[model samples]
Target: MNSSLFAVIMMLAVLIPSGMQAQAPATYYNSAYGKSGKALKTELHEIIKSGYVTKSYDFLYTIYEESDTRPDGKLWDMYSTCTWTHGQKKCGNYSTVCDCYNREHSIPQSWFNERSPMVSDAHHIYPTDGRVNGQRGNDPFGECANGTTLTNGLGRSGSSTFPGYSGRVFEPVDEYKGDFARTYFYFVTRYEDLMSTFSTSSTSFSGNAYPSLNSWSIALFLKWHRQDPVSEKEIVRNNAVYKHQKNRNAFIDHPILAEHIWGTLQGSAWDVTGVETPAELLARVNYNANERSMMVAADLGELSYEVVNISGVRLLSGTLLGGDAVSMGSLKPGVYFFRANADTLKAVKKFIVQ
Candidate 1:
């Protein structure tokens, strides 16, 4: 064989096996294609349920050491910025903020009465400062306004400041907001059937697979999911957990799936079509905000568009021809979301109407 041909064959041999391995696990989601709402959520639950390996609470320490460590090789404590030595703070009682970290149930165990799988689920458990973990104490996540009780740079526990709920709650820093939102999304979907048996006093979780979160909490989490987006840390942790638990969080794999299941973007657009990357969908259309109009690329073919306010109220809806502009001249000066939809395409862009 020619040297060049042999080199090409060698490269292919090395790449083929790794590529196949990467694609194998995701094949579990094949049945979920073109599904949305309750159907999508239930399909995911069943697909992921098969691989879940329940670990004891004690096992989490070993897992966190591998999964939650910061790049600097220190324990990654979400509740505080304190640096912790590895394994120094495993489940120890603390009266104040210490140098050690402990297992924190982002979803408190008491909420489910310490049920087996839910109690030990690493998807919702994090390693955080022991003192701050105590302060959080099963509180539902929310923004704090007044009556501050604990402030640890990275998290806070206090009276609720967020609208729609006025109970005490714990709020993590902005950096991890999307991370927690995805985790919550995973919790509701993966354990949708088990939610009815858990406490709902401080939770927004409902028993149903669709609309699993109550209105207020859903709105808050959706906003957070968009604002923070997904980060590399989340992607890395998600892959690590999949290795241990044998299931993947579909929301992390496809962030838009959350919208299909519970948010405003649901319908046949997402139901009949598979998920698309934001860039792939956005590349199909272009918006000229100065003229308050959008132009669909010819390759995208004909499409429909809607202009909605930040609150998701539809202000205008119309069809757009390929290569032609759809005017938004009648829209009032404000912020709005430009949503484009086609048979197999869905994209949303935020624009200011000034």
Candidate 2:
């Protein structure tokens, strides 16, 4: 079908669930004028034009905070201050702000011949580094080659050891991998037409030989969606960007947004039998979390859970029980996992310190 119709169908699919065809909760209002595809396309152009006056490469550096030698001041350095100025040392492995980053293009501008709206799109561009961007290259993302050796773990860059798929892929550090994966998902879905012209042998592309995403790319994206899932940071940034730019993407709207899109459009669900939350039988087993002694519970039917930090290291897991409180008194004063699982439902709740 057409892009507009396709988006509508997908949205509908997301609102309604499978196995049971109950009406969707009226929580989300379609703000896209009932025209998601073309309207978004037009909106993208407008957003770019509006930001044309204020956007500068320098602004990018500021957003992530890289060291600046330029008289104009450094964007990266400023961003670093925002993210990690509290500690003298960088929160990440890098020793300095400059060492830690580059102004990364979330959507490689090359796909649209480096067009304006797509080129400097703030929604997709991020402050990454050269090494990580190089490893990521233009290849579509997927499971790395079995022997893929890591070049820069901090940048999340690596070469796949998998035959046929052995290519450079910028694997994101655990913290933002899910966000990056979701960005790619949003990009392709947004620009389905432009996707065909781009290369697609690696995990970076859709892997579909037809200039569109092949099944492999789709499957890989689905996997990435799970492994390096969304974070609170992304949500905060997403809202900030939307407010600042007056443009928003569905992927940035919610973690489960993709599930809705894919389910509605493709009628498929993300598989997670081996990858989902842990068993509920482990409940009542004390686990340390977030420097606070807390209780954990699970609802087997819902796959919902909570995580209380007993120590710094987060004891995170999924698919346990929901509403079933587990004790945290015996555990140490650090991060802990109080996972809850009930079928396909899943969440990672973070608790604070005393």
Candidate 3:
């Protein structure tokens, strides 16, 4: 974003307060506007699924060096308090928690038949203590009452403490609950198209695109997402993952996006501002094939927008007002995103055209 566009954006939408700050460029969230509930979830699904780079399961070890490294160069294993050097200890075999580290599928591979993209996706695969990973044993994440504590004494595995289910469950420490919750959110949304085909044996997922989580899991994850909040560790990891994976954890980038689909913001338009809206005002782009032009329209009062390709390369940018149709007829045929923002159209550097 240039200085002039930033000035236009600030004048269009009200700035959201601290908790739900919007982070991406003006064009990143354009197609998701005026959508809520399932529609919002679908928009998010499309956004996160774009440009995904599929690495082999073995490559997760490489990903952790950047995504989960602690300041002292130790693996940030949430499953145990044990300290570990990045590549020094592989999970050869472990009788104790600190003996070795391995890839722990936060969403266990069995539930999805150990398939391709899902199996290799680094977003849900975490480097964890082998012993604690064994303790989890494919249980759903939840509060456990009188649960068996791990060797490090932070995580627990036991019968349910939460309502609606009494099955065995695993619970991590409070500090990382939000991180795990948001990871689950990204997993379900990104794979939503295939969700209906996934096995629902775990009882956490309903296997549906919208409200994909089971009743109990929905309550549990929402509670976790609200309590833990996004942290600096998550922000750093999000960037690192996108650098390799080509997509983002939208829930981490815009925590309020979760509310629009599953919590408080339901039934409301998905706006970057998160302001209360009285009606369903729509904004969209339609390419006029006859004239070889891109047509953008919005009822968002005065606005600022940028046309960018999937790689974040800017093609065109300017301001628009009212319900008028603005055309870019000279533009060639190609897929482009029409992003709208208030005054926060800062530097969109991920993709820059020379």
| Candidate 3 vs. true structure, TM-score | 0.70
Per-residue C-alpha lDDT of model 2 across residues 125-168, encoded as one tens digit per residue: 77554444555556444444332333333434356543345556
lDDT of model 1 at position 181: 86
Off by over 4 Å in 1: 1-24, 147-153, 269-354
TM-score of each: 0.70, 0.57, 0.70
For residues 1-354, what per-residue lDDT tens digits would candidate 1 score against the true structure?
565755554443233222212222536678888878888888888987887999888888877766676544677787887888777756556677764578888888887898889888888899888788888788888888554545453677788888888888888776577788888989888888887777778876665556777777888798788755554355556666777888877776677888888777667334324334433455556557568777777766677877778555888888877787887788886656677766534546555454
- Kindly give the stretch of ten consecutive residues in candidate 1 with the minimal lDDT sum: 15-24
lDDT by candidate, in order shown: 0.71, 0.43, 0.72
lDDT of 3 by residue, 1-354 (tens): 575654443332221111122234547768988899999999989988877899888888888887887544568888888898988889898898888989989998888889989998888888999999999988989999698986674589999989988889999887678889989999999999988888888658898887888888878898988755555466667766776777778877777778889997798887766322111111133344445444444544665666767544677788777455556564554434455543322111111121
Question: Global CA lDDT of candidate 2, please?
Answer: 0.43
- Scored against the true structure, residue 27 in model 1 reaches a CA lDDT of 64
Kindly indicate the candidate among 2 and 3 with the higher TM-score: 3
**Predicted structure 1: lDDT:** 0.71
* Candidate achieving higher lDDT, 2 or 3: 3
